[model samples]
Target: MTVVAPPTLAPPPPPGAYKDPKASAVASRAWRWLWLPLLILVLVIAGASVVFIVDLDSSDTGTLNPHSYRPDGGNALRVLTEQYGTPVDTPSTSADALKAGLGGDVTLLIPDTAPLSVRTIQSLKALPPSTRVVLLAPDRGALHVLFPDLDFGDFPATSPVAPNCDAPEAKAAGSIDFDGAGYLPKTIHAAHVTSCYQGGLLLVSDSTGPEFALLGDANLLTNEHLTGYGHAALGINLLSTHSRVEWLYLDQPESASSEGGDGSQALFPPWVDAASLYLILAGVLVALWQARRLGVPVPEPLPVVVRSAETVEGRARLYRRAGARKLAAESLRGGALARITPALGLGADPDPRALIIALAQRSGRTTQEIHRLLYSPPPTDDQGLLALATELDRLVDDYLTQLTIGRAGADQGNNPEGPQQ
Candidate 1:
């Protein structure tokens, strides 16, 4: 018995059949290698974020930090004082200042009052009558104890103002930088206070008792503004009046441990505990609700089927939107060549020159023109790409038509139609 082979409709798809993409791509060694760098990048970013947050609360690195020479630092002022023979001593806490200043001859300069504990405030008020206390604008919290008769109010900007009264420091400094803390003297004790800079009482001095001096703002002493107005001279004269200077810089907020306290309840704010309880109750409710519906997962085939052609179109649209005409033209040329190769009886992976020659002979086109169409450098713009695509489609169609006609003629010649035999 004799058997005839079926007519070839299309070529086999480039060796391997359509394979489902590996679902375990993430588990593959190549993917594992790619993820290592990404994981490292994420860890690096997280570490940087934590460092940035910690740096935000630092005082030694900030403008007002005595040791820092940065634009905002008090390094210039510190150097100036040391030049005048009275070196600035930085004490970590209020207790350290009190211990050093107990000699009465030592001057205590509290640059910031944010970290002052309840005990520190009380101890400062009862310092030796001989010790002088210079405080840079104490916040509203410390104002009650430090300035018993002063009311905290808006601090408005003021032009260079002279010391109108007999206060020697004010008069000697002559037109000083007075844009500082505003104080409203409310009681009989505050009547003796010397005020300056409009509403801002830049200095409040009491010479009879433990002398206390209040500055309006700390900016006057920073490196950026130290040379402006009479800031440098005033800051130097004010800090150097004593034999020794103790610059008390409070770094952190008053801790519960320092107050002799323990446990989260005492350490953290009350609202934090209440919020945590609500969150825990919500999580428990969600868990209980989900537990009722939990069961063995049922296996099912995918309901929707997406064709590779749809993916190709989507990628093409993206390339078009991004103006990636060169890449798009190359893809169009590759696809056209892939289909044209089989239609011309040239097997897969045929040499480009040979394929062009064969296509030219069958389609009655020049070899150079065919070569340019298939393997030319990518088109410059979208318009050129569109024209190239049209040419490629026409070439493929012409070649396919020629192939069909040639095959029909060969078939007829092979089996000749003889007279009725």
Candidate 2:
């Protein structure tokens, strides 16, 4: 009997992304081994994309979590859009547009009601003198809380540029003439913006040459400000005076690997966010391994997941113990065919004679007969069943050997994962 290779077709593309018939690969004697690597690849991809979206694992950079704000949406993209009714553009982003927004442009950024970080404060302070300034950051670290109920009369009416406000911080902030005198710049969206939160410091600085406006907190830029209840208008109003004003938005990127959190006192110390991932992986693996051992439900037994192979193995063992070889052989043949038909391009209900004819036509098989070798009666005894299993085994080996050559050809850069086997 001479064995020949089957017809070669173009290799299939990736599965799931593009559902190909090839993805439902035909199985054989050693076919189960391939799924182990496939399963591992799937697990790795799922774990990486879903889990590391924000809580990344890298030592160099930090994550800029868009969703971590006190409110649901306080990320840089939303911040720029809601504030200016436009996409983001900043000194760092589009420097060419700088001259357009300068020269009598005034813009304000209030971190008052929200928590304002020291870095945020320094960045805001770095604006030009012509730009207006308002220091509304309260104790929350970012300007999140704005004083609404507080009366103007109750305000100290003194220069708040002392230790608390940006007064002393101005020198370090490197503002031009911020150490000198200047008048308060008014904004169109003041009352509406102010109504949302408490008041912070009102600063007047140069945004560009001849441009000026206010800077302070409606609440203050806090990490905890909720959506639809923010003082975004106040920031816009501060910038409204500019004939052509641009908000110098400082946005944190979304996929950073490192960031600061409550890690100092975290229970897991060095691995704050990674603990949950490990626990889930361990649990899933344990469940799969112990699925059969606890297949028959008992009182207080944990859950498990049984793969098709394990289920088959369990049934085979039971049949052997009961001395039912014929039944066992029938099951074994059915399982083996279930894997092979798809692999060899024979339909699910392939007639053994037709399969032989097709194989002969496609791969030039000459005298290899698969009738008694494939669809014989179930074994009547232990020896017969073992013989049937052995026949099934050889058929599987031949099919796989042919499949390996096909795979090798497909992988010469013309295909991705070789021919679907």
Candidate 3:
């Protein structure tokens, strides 16, 4: 008798507590397999990044590089020069260019003059008088250092202009594409300067010095422009004058000190830029994917509820504040007509005469009074508008009441019990 069972203490389970074991197992299996697709996506992104970095570093590509096959490169011009029976030599440094230029009768072509150092400029000044030096879009400082008698006066003309000078090269080339800086001779030495294409091309020569030719636009020699308007003839004429040509393709400015010359002065490797660009693009794609919604938007109930009477009163207040009495009267008249017309069994666009007659016969009001209430001119003042609204409400109420009474009388006549004796 003392070993009685203890009462059960757990509560009963809620309704629908059971779930499909098969479905639960399927969900768990799907979650476990999600990592396969995730791993594949990560591997694809990493592989693409590696390929992009490898491709970017695989070639020596630049704007004016003679070996670059890009549109803005000088590879086409270089090929054309070779085809025209002139030997072309690409010098990597200022020393190499100076040595090549001084070795024999060679034409030195400098596409960019920003990296030229003072020592290089001095060395160029000491070259033989027979050597021809071509400068593409040189700035004022370089021109001052190399030729003190000439400088850039104004912006160069970008449109095609006829060669207005008597130079044999300009006459042969005719109208060359002009998109470079213009040159002007110093007042004292204006006689020594020979200009063409409105000063877009200049030639400076003295009896005891090397000849200097300044081309205002460097795009004239680019592969993209070489085939356009007299560009091929102009480029060939300038660079192919001598049997040998030396092109100075300097990527960076020469360091003045010998201590920092061993390593490059760039802040980061070239692949870093490509990698950063790819990472930014990947981040954008991930953000867009994660932010995508699954289906059409679901409408939610408004947080606050507003009553119809309050809304009408608010609109009335606004109309009164704006002094729109005529508009208020028109709205009141229109609402009354719409309700009364439907009750009178009239069509949507009933004849105006028939509508007036129906309202007049039902409400015992004159046809003119019904017409005035329904279709009169709008009110001019607030008092007139209020009067119009009150009249309209009275008219609609009378018409509906008369209609109900008529229906009730007709029903009583047809009833067998005879008027609820």
Please name the candidate that would achieve the greatest lDDT relative to the true structure: 3
Better of 1 and 3 by TM-score: 3
Ranking by lDDT: 3, 1, 2
Candidate 1 matches the true fold with a TM-score of 0.47
What lDDT does each candidate get?
0.70, 0.42, 0.76
Worst 10 residues of 1 by lDDT: 15-24
**Which has the better TM-score: candidate 1, or candidate 2?**
1
For candidate 2, the TM-score is: 0.32
lDDT of 2 by residue, 173-265 (tens): 221111222222233223222211112334322323222222332222233332222233333344344443343333432121111233234
Candidate 2 all-Cα RMSD: 20.6
TM-score of each: 0.47, 0.32, 0.48
Candidate 2 deviant stretches above 4 angstroms:
1-26, 44-120, 123-126, 134-201, 204-236, 244-374, 377-383, 386-421
Judging by lDDT, tell me the better candidate of 1 and 2.
1
lDDT of 2 at 248: 35
